[model samples]
Target: MISEQFDLSNRLGRGDRTALGIWFWELDRVLLALILSLLAIGLLAVAAASPATARRLSSADVSLPELYFFYRQFAWAVIAFVTMLVISMFPKNMVRRMALIGFAAMVVAMLFTIILGSEINGAKRWINLGFMSFQASEFLKPFYAVAIAWVVSWKLKDKSLPVYPIIFAITGFLAMILMLQPDLGQTILLSGICFAVIMVSGVKFWKLAALFGMGIGGLVTAYFTYSVAATRIDAFLFGTDGITHDKLALSTLSAGGLFGVGPGLGERKYSLPEAHTDYIFSVIGEEFGLLACAAIIIIYFAIIIRVALRLFEEKDYFTILAVTGLVTQFCGQAMINIAVNLGMFPSKGMTLPFISYGGSSLWSISITSGLILALTRRNPFMHKQGQNRRYNR
Candidate 1:
């Protein structure tokens, strides 16, 4: 969106440059507030879920503090905030380039993961750096969105599916690695983002249909071709696998109705698996009640819809597709997680994006939202009185 005025440098000035040489904008304030709001929700959800988890993992002699997970998450939140601020200050081109670099790096990391990564929990999804594991799939979601947005946005005189194969190859390669992780969840999420970008590009329907066919074929391969995948899907369908965690989550949601049992008074936390990670929404339902859960869902929808509504005000294709990909994937995954919670879908290990309590995912998603803000920040003209009135957002 900022590019409309890029050539007219004399017409616009980068907002007060800092020692870091980064600029600022009015949109930054609004976007930052939204990001922080998600963090606040994360903190609240973690507070409700962590104590129970900690007790399970702790010894009776060593009683854990209520703030154990909360403090660690707070620290990560602080780190993520700084990371977000630094990214937000960069120029639009710089933002795009940085995301491209991240995408490229994750591509290479995924390759290495296939060759030499450890397989844990039956999914080879992590690269061990001695001290920690890096989930390349998680880190790549935002980057891939930006990279694809940057790639597809060029108004090509040639209407052909120019260089799209390369994008698909890279995307497919990443999906292959996640499938190796046996992580159908991430693979599906990645595909959803890819689909959103492709659809928004106004590409021919035949191309979309072909890709859709290929994607469904790939999922079939992932399920039947890979033993781990086949096992999970089979378990999901027959409800007969050694794995039986999702039912607990559904039960938890059923327990929490209109008003929730009130926070911290949850009985389900003790029995529900991943109470703080993939299934935190279930806890919200169980303790806070369905009304509270609905309120959380409303927050997520508001964020996604609010972002999508403003894309037309963007001056460039990159911003539109990038925001579209990011928001679409986010809301899509959130819906699936909610669906699973409601027993409308099979158990899928999908985390509730910003609200999940894992280490890397929260940090990565915060940075991703920061990138979206950086890319989608409205130009000064877009926010002017007349422009806002005209856009009708």
Candidate 2:
């Protein structure tokens, strides 16, 4: 019975005519393993942070179960993985169409959020449905990347099109809404994704420089105008009490030394706000050590490198651009989250991908993983047959 099951599961034929059959045969297994490993580590990290988080919340009469966040995060992980699998089954044209529709819906939702969303940490970024609060920006990112890549690919195919200007206009509109939400982090993050797509699409050097200058100028304006940005900058550069989180994160990381204090035995996590969400990396450091942190970083880098390597030989412009944008956004968010934990950058309140205890972040990142998987999949037999045909010719 086990042999029958294994045979049924492991084999795929060119004659097979099903979506699952194609995906099962073509999906990049190494990339999937790396992502699943990160999700597993995230669960462990959240488990470590749960007691402290629960205690802190319960003290304020928030009344959560001791492992509430961990359990919820686990549930989110399941949903995220399922979403990724379903999305990966979609064909390229369908993915693009879906992204178009999803982007429009998210834009409308974001506008509504700006008007009626719940305020958290002095930022209005979530729309509270009766069941849960959803962050539209989290869901918007992958679709936004797809939409931008689609537009840029069109310009690549037709030189007469005024593509860069259209990109700029859309970016400006989106940036305006994001800044109105006062989410400077996401505004910058999405801008980086767009810039990466533009860069890969081969825009003029002067135009690229102008975009970079605009980004810098936007940062300056944000630092001066928003107290949140200003406070983080002041804390990071001038040294202020506002850096309690940063200081705690660094000290805890340092305290862990080479190895960790052991899982669920972390002390400093109790004092750090958002330990389960934004600073879970530090919790991992404190419990599992710098070696584990390094391993995590390497896995993230490996995934990016693997994706880029797969796309190196790809001839499809849309596939290359869409995957590039998605991977850039994925690795970019991971870098920002880790940088803030290490005190290398100002606090951004961005959750570590896969590892952070947030439903929206987990699900969004899973969608990104699925997109990468679908775009990178190449049929082994087709590749072999192409090589054979070339040799014969």
Candidate 3:
């Protein structure tokens, strides 16, 4: 029996006519390649930034290895890769079901986090899971996007469902919860995802304009009402009581003008905080240069464009909306991280997706990439048949 099982697995690996084989052939290979490329780049970036972070955290009594974070990040990347592949193999219905269920679970987890979570950086966002500290909000993002998309797409089936108000309530409630955690970055991101999905769902122009105006107003309110936001904004605008991370990041990022100073040779990264997480982009810029940073941005644009092209011919409203939400969340986070590193935006503790060194972030982003893969999976044979049937009709 063992030998037979091994043979069957080998056959599947060899691309035999099995479910795994079918998935291998049907899933979007180009997008998969792009995602893997980002993961690979992430490992390299982590390796480059690990020494600085490790040293910074080292104490007189306990010394950390230079590559400690890199090693752990590598392990997380491997696990996250496997998770992405497995989730990508799930069918569309399964994906939707998973997102809905996961969203509920994450909401519960967020509630628990609010009550019993450990505080980090003066925020109660992470809950201890014995072996690891899990940030519920980080994992909530992809699920929230899919859930919102699924709920909003109901209008296509029945226009009287009041989906808009339902989504608004959900978004508002979640925003309230996130603000209580004082995670302004996530609250802003969640709002952006909600707005983008509604806009893409063909909502009225007036509503979009109203939402945009409200978004601006919300920023103004945050600046006044949220101490963290107000401080960061004041620092960015007037350089009063500014954080050192942003200044160090800008200096490190510009140290390698066009071509990098070369990998592992950046001295400025030593003083840059969160070098392996929030400030990893600056490390990349210092070690790999401005050209490398531009390349990373270009790769992000490629992934977004690739997804957009894939959705061009999609007929399912839910798929279009879900994919749009996921992509917005993914790319939006990356844009924010890069913007912060470049001193164009206030520091928001956002991680560059698939590039930052953190277990929760890696897992969350991997699940996100997996959902995108699953939703966008195309069976050429079925697609052809559907077209033929439409022609016959």
* TM-score for each predicted model, relative to the true structure: 0.86, 0.95, 0.94
> What is the Cα root-mean-square deviation between model 1 and the actual structure?
6.1
Worst 10 residues of 3 by lDDT: 8-17
What's model 2's TM-score? Answer: 0.95
Scored by lDDT, model 3 comes in at 0.93
Per-residue accuracy of model 3 over 1-393 as CA lDDT, tens digit each: 999998877773534668977898789999999999999999999999999999999999999999999999999999999999999999999999999999999999999999999999888999988877899999999999999999998887899999989998998899889988889999989999999999999999999999989889989988889999898888888888657668779999999889999999999999987999999999999999999999999999999999998899899999999999999999999999999998999999999999999999999999999999999998777888988999999
Model number with the top lDDT: 3
Per-candidate local distance difference test: 0.76, 0.89, 0.93
Off by over 4 Å in 3: 1-16, 384-393
Give lDDT tens digits, candidate 2, residues 80-194: 9999888888878889998899999999999998999999878899987766679999989999999988988887678898877887898889889988888989998999999
How far in Å is the alpha carbon of 334 misplaced in model 2? 0.4
Q: Which is the winner by lDDT between candidate 1 and candidate 2?
A: 2
Model 2 clash count equals: 0
Clashes of 1: 3
Candidate 1 local lDDT, 144-180, one digit each (tens): 8888777787645455646577678767877777776
Report each candidate's C-alpha RMSD, comma-separated, in the order given: 6.1, 2.2, 3.0
